[model samples]
Target: MSRFSLVRSAPAPTPAALAAPPPVAPPAARVESKPKSPARDAGLDLRLRLHAKLIEELDLAKLDKLDEAELRRQVLGQVTEFARIERMALNARELEALGASIYDEMVGLGPIEPLLKDDSINDILINGPYQVYIERRGELELTPIRFRDNDHLLRIVNRIVAAVGRRIDESQPMVDARLPDGSRVNAAIPPVAIDGCSVSIRKFSKKPLTLEKLVEFGAMTQSMSDFLYGAVRSRVSTVISGGTGSGKTTLLNALSSAISEGERLITIEDAAELQLQQPHVVRMETRPPNIEGKGEIRQRELVKNALRMRPDRVILGEVRSEEAFDMLQAMNTGHEGSMATIHSNNPREAISRLEQMVAMGGLNIGADAVRHQIAAAVGLVVQVMRLSDGKRKVTHVTEITGMEGQVVQMQDIFVFNRTHTGPDGEVFGEFRATGLRPRCLDEMIRRGIPYDTANFDPSKVLG
Candidate 1:
């Protein structure tokens, strides 16, 4: 029987005839003597088995022909009829939850559907069928969600990849993709993963974060935002450098909002994630090779193609490969206000990394020549990083001041002084200028871009 039997632990001070003890002591009395607790229902296993049978009996042909409303009605009818046949009983809430789970298993990524719908979950990492983890509010926690087995996990992965017109198998075990909502997804299976399929999803926010919002989050100060706005307006070729998950793309999205709506912008990425609200923006993404290993479109080709598209500014999502050379050439060539991001910790490291990437382009140029090109092409490198307490901040606003001797010369006008951490583990620091007047200020003013050098005085600190 699915019904719960409540047995009182203590004798009743006042009793009625209906409460009389059973002719033979009640079966529940043996358990009530031990502890005072509510009775646990024993129908959980039966309900699970019934759910599986219903799913197995589902007719895909009939299901496919119905609209959402019709589908829900049909599924609900089948569930209710099945429960009646099995002599099972469920409360209203339990019935609704089971209906949702069945629908999700048939139509979505089962077990993780709720996580995907949660706006607060920033990341969803599925190690295998038996374990699922999610990142919420910058903290990682294990979840009770799981697939039936490894094969079940693989089925979901295949469904996701197939929707994107891609596939991952033994021959090609790792792939990058995006969900319908534009969340970035990466999957590695079997041999490389060792355990099973490993899937990482970087969730996309529906509302793009703004500079004002970032200030509220203590990501940057008002003065810093003003300086960046002025710099972008001055048509400075800028690059954002940061480690992974350092809010490079989020900051870039915020910065791109400052671009004049009149200008045409072309953005390129392996997976398009930037949400530029400008009306005249064109976005493109690279395509991977087919199963036979042919027909690949790399970012380097896109960079070369963007030159002919008459773009007022080109936004390379990231400069990571031979494309770095093409990106530099674009900046040197008349697309002076172009912007891109690179993976680096500091300005000096970013410059060195760019130089190395230039060589990666197979250009037969010495380091000095590459540094010369960088010095003339790039104007600023803004370094951002995630603090220990899970805060992201613009750490440095550096100016590339031409070549000094054999190296590229750069100076940090503003920097985050990460002096120490507080007792609560919050990063304690202040953003301050390095006391050097930016040479860009003079050029910015000359170009009719309003810039005030007073805000960058070295003696003043900003937080």
Candidate 2:
């Protein structure tokens, strides 16, 4: 090896060897710490421990067999004894509230019962056991309420489905049913729900809102309500279209009240919720399949059967499936004054949905044929929308004239023009006339319904 090789072969002087180790410093002081844990509440613990003791002391199985009155008495007795023994630190008012909450959990929805009893809650949306939201006065608010665990939430969902005599599990994980108070419930669980159970409840008031009441509530103008009153009385085939929860069914119910009480009326719904007050009305609800997957009745079947019942007016709670074709056919074939709701953002989409639904009904026809049928059968399209401010307004009230070329022509007689949103997130707009006269005024005159041409003029916009 060369001297250069010897020089290279020498162990390279290491930086750590050449440089003295940094002077050792004193160790930093150790700070004592504890494992992080969630905050604890004495009230929650007292109630929970009391509930646990009551479960053991009382026979829940026998309690289930007892009637509501006896059950309440037994539960109250158990709570009274448990409170006396535990000597709970809570005051009397707090103790009573705890007892009531326990009772609600036993006989009603547990954490959700309070929300259900809330009159101002329009909707309850549960993402899981921990995330509960409510739609109150048209705005969403996250609530601190939660289920004890995922299993607790699942149990409540199962209970709700069981009460309605429907079943949802891994095999069939979705269900739509109505509560005893007529609130619509939709639920889904895993594997359909990856996280946990999800539920949406759309609440209905016990006393339905009327057209005049809706006007008073700022949902629509008096002039618009007047036009709708005239339209319904004149036997017009109307379709209310909008996004989900946009007040479609509410509008449908209000319009049905305008139908002459003398006419024999029939209503078909997946769930019987139309609270029409007509004396001669017959209500029909569809049924799901049995456990054996038989004995199912669809809305299309009901629509076809309703025609044979010789009804003067047929109201469909909604036309969602192939039933749209039958509903349209009914509208044309002497079923005047018929009404149904469709999901669409605007009037034109409503027309297109009708055609699509016709195709869905196994009609072997061209698009033009379906469009033509929609043009003839459907007369007025009232578009309702839930605005950004949580207020529902009549966004568009359009009239469908005959087809211009291949497309069905629509004229917007009234429209809510939203030009801007306010700084506070409120929608700023006004209902304006589209400067087009409605053709239905001629029908009003022919039918002799109470209406004025001045009310249906082109220039009368309402805010």
Task: For each candidate, give its TM-score against the true structure.
Answer: 0.85, 0.85
Question: What is the lDDT for 293 in model 2?
Answer: 84
For residue 317, what is the lDDT in candidate 1?
A: 87
lDDT, candidate 1, 129-182, per-residue tens: 667899886778998676655667888898888888888999889988888887
lDDT by residue (tens digit), candidate 2, 297-319: 99999999999999998899998
Off by over 4 Å in 1: 1-70, 446-452
Residue 210 alpha-carbon offset, candidate 2, angstroms: 1.4
Among residues 3 or more apart in sequence or in different chains, the pairs in candidate 1 whose N, CA or C atoms overlap within 3 Å are: 435-458
Which regions of candidate 2 deviate over 4 angstroms? 1-73, 457-460
Residue 169 accuracy (lDDT) in model 2 = 84
Q: Model 2: which residue pairs collide?
A: none
Deviation (Å) of 427 in candidate 1: 1.4
Whole-model Cα lDDT per candidate? 0.80, 0.80
